[model samples]
Target: MHPSTLMMGYGYEPRLSEGALKPPIFLTSTYAFESAADGKRFFEGITGKRPGGSEGLVYGRFNGPNQEILEDRLAQWERAEEALSFSSGMSAIGTALMAHVQPGDVIVHSAPLYAATEKMIDAVFGKFGVKWVDFPAHASPAEIEETIERAKGLGRVSVIYLESPANPTNDLVDIEAVSALRDRMFADAEHRPVIMCDNTFLGPCFQAPTQNGADMSVYSLTKYVGGHSDLVAGAVVGTRDALAPILALRNTLGTITDPNTAWMLLRSLETVQLRMEKAESNARAVATFLKDHPKVERVSWLGFLDPSSSQGEIFKRHCSGAGSTFSVIVKGGEPEAFRLLDNLKTVKLAVSLGGTESLASHPAAMTHLSVPEARRAELGIGDNLVRVSIGVEHEDDLVADFEQALKAV
Candidate 1:
């Protein structure tokens, strides 16, 4: 069955709880053991002495039916063998990276990363003695190889992390090329770098990173997965073998999403595809409107990629749809961008993307503020850049909003 079809009821049995159509939230701190022998067995499973069966739930943090069901659904969506949910997207990224790397190890990542992630790698992880190197989003396959080789000169390349259709700016990273690069670089070595892709911008339906040779796929479930801005959550999905260590770290660090949030995700999963499709439609219309506007200097949207360009070819090969979030460079700098943002009536001025309501923000001062000025310029996150997250709204309404807002500038 299709993933969206399966999402309606897969991994959940209606007969389990009074024939309830929806899974009820298991809002307890822990579960009761059937017997002392059963408790022993559960603990043995937790300690790896025995295989862990899905039937038993020992504690909320360790396991829960809501979390398990949600994980199962997410794994199904991404075509993954297993999945782990986290309290936030950063927890998922941090725990997965920490599980794979140690002191003196190096991480090779693509630039224009989400600001928080860049800070975590450079400021927090750097203090812990792990080093990081970055290649530009549009780096050629050969340039990526050189970057990896340079990182290897310092230490093992433990992780190759990438955020494609990168935050705010819709830059495409070649996932298959990076995966091949990892294989070529580590052909003779016992240790291999794990390729992790952050698929938050496009979501699971638009792009499946694992299918493109990524070892693992990560997401800020707070965005499209939740569909509403009411909850904060994240997810990691991959083969069971690839996710084992990350899950182990999640268990120890208590980074698991709570039962209520898991339940919310479960509810959101039912309609995510519909919401995303509508948003994509709206985005296409909005991008077209902005492209023809006299005040708009340039628009960075996946749909607008020149077919002859290398990035466009990569996008054609990997991504199925041009997602809703993209950037617009106005005629002037921050003052003009801020004026347009401040004048928008339909789209709210906000930070996060992939929500039910449209949002717009100045990336230079908002989302990527932590990045150095020079680096931001190189990434094309200019003072005139304004990022927009198109929601499932009427195309005409959104276009009119942008028209009036641009006039304010």
Candidate 2:
């Protein structure tokens, strides 16, 4: 069944909820067990003393019916074996990193990470003696392999982190190529590194990382999955074996989303496909209009990518759409870019994307500001770049709004 159809009621039963036709938010911190033995059995299963088949609820932070249902339904989006939800995107990311990393391990990753994440790796992880090495997201597989080889001098490589259509730039990474390189490089190692892909920019609708050989697919549910900008959440999906440590760490850290937020996520899932379809169409039209404008220097929308190029081929294999977010470099520098942003009446000047309303952000000065000046320029995050996220608005209206805004330049 399609994700849209399954989202309605895949992991829930109406009769279990007093025939209400939808699961209620079980707003309780603790649950009643039938007997002492039942409580023991559940804990044993959770702690891995018993392999499987643990039934009944325990604690809200540990496990709840709403969160379970949300995880089950989300797994179907990427066809993953298991899924876990968290209070926020960074919580999910931090917990996943801790589960697989240790004091002496290294993280070899693609550059242009979300600003906060890069800062966390530099500040927090550095205190524990864990090191990180990075290369551009567009680096060839062989080039990335050389970087990994260089990282071995520092510590054992435990994680290969990536964010495709990376943050504000929308650069595509070859997930399959990286996975193959990891296999070739570390076949006889003590423990091979895990490929963790952040699917926030184009997930659930267009890209499936695990299907392309990544060990885990991570997401900021605040973006595409939540769709309405009403809630904040995150998730990770992978095979049950790959996720065992992550689940254990999540329970220890109490990072699971609340029952109420889980219920809201359930509501949003129903219309994700529909919302994404409309927004993608609007983005294609918007990019086309901007491409021909004399004042627009470049539109980094993937829909305009040359199909014969390496990046385009990888995008074709991994993503089904260009998605609604892309960056535009204006003819003039920062002054003209700021004018366009200031003149927009309908679209918002905002930091976050994938909301119901359109938004524009300056990558160099706003979103990716934490990155150093030289590094930002190297990553193609120029001062004139304005990252635009198209919404489900009428294409004509969106184009007209952009046209009027560009006139200020």
Misplaced by over 4 Å in model 1 are 51-55
Q: Candidate 2 regions off by >4 Å?
A: none
Candidate 2 on 1-409: residue-level lDDT in tens?
A: 9878999999999997899778999999999999999999999987878886347788886889999999999999899999999999999999999999999789998888888788777778889898999988888888888898988888899999999988888888899999998998899999899999999989989999999989999999999889888899999998888788898888789999999999999999999989888999999999999999999999989888889898889888999988999999999889999999999988899988888889999988997888899988887788999999899988999999999999999
TM-score of 2: 0.98
Scored by lDDT, model 1 comes in at 0.90
For model 1 the local lDDT of residue 340 reads: 96
**Per-candidate local distance difference test:** 0.90, 0.90
Candidate 1 lDDT over 190-232, as tens digits, reads 8999999999999878999999999999999999999899999
lDDT accuracy of residue 406 in candidate 2: 90
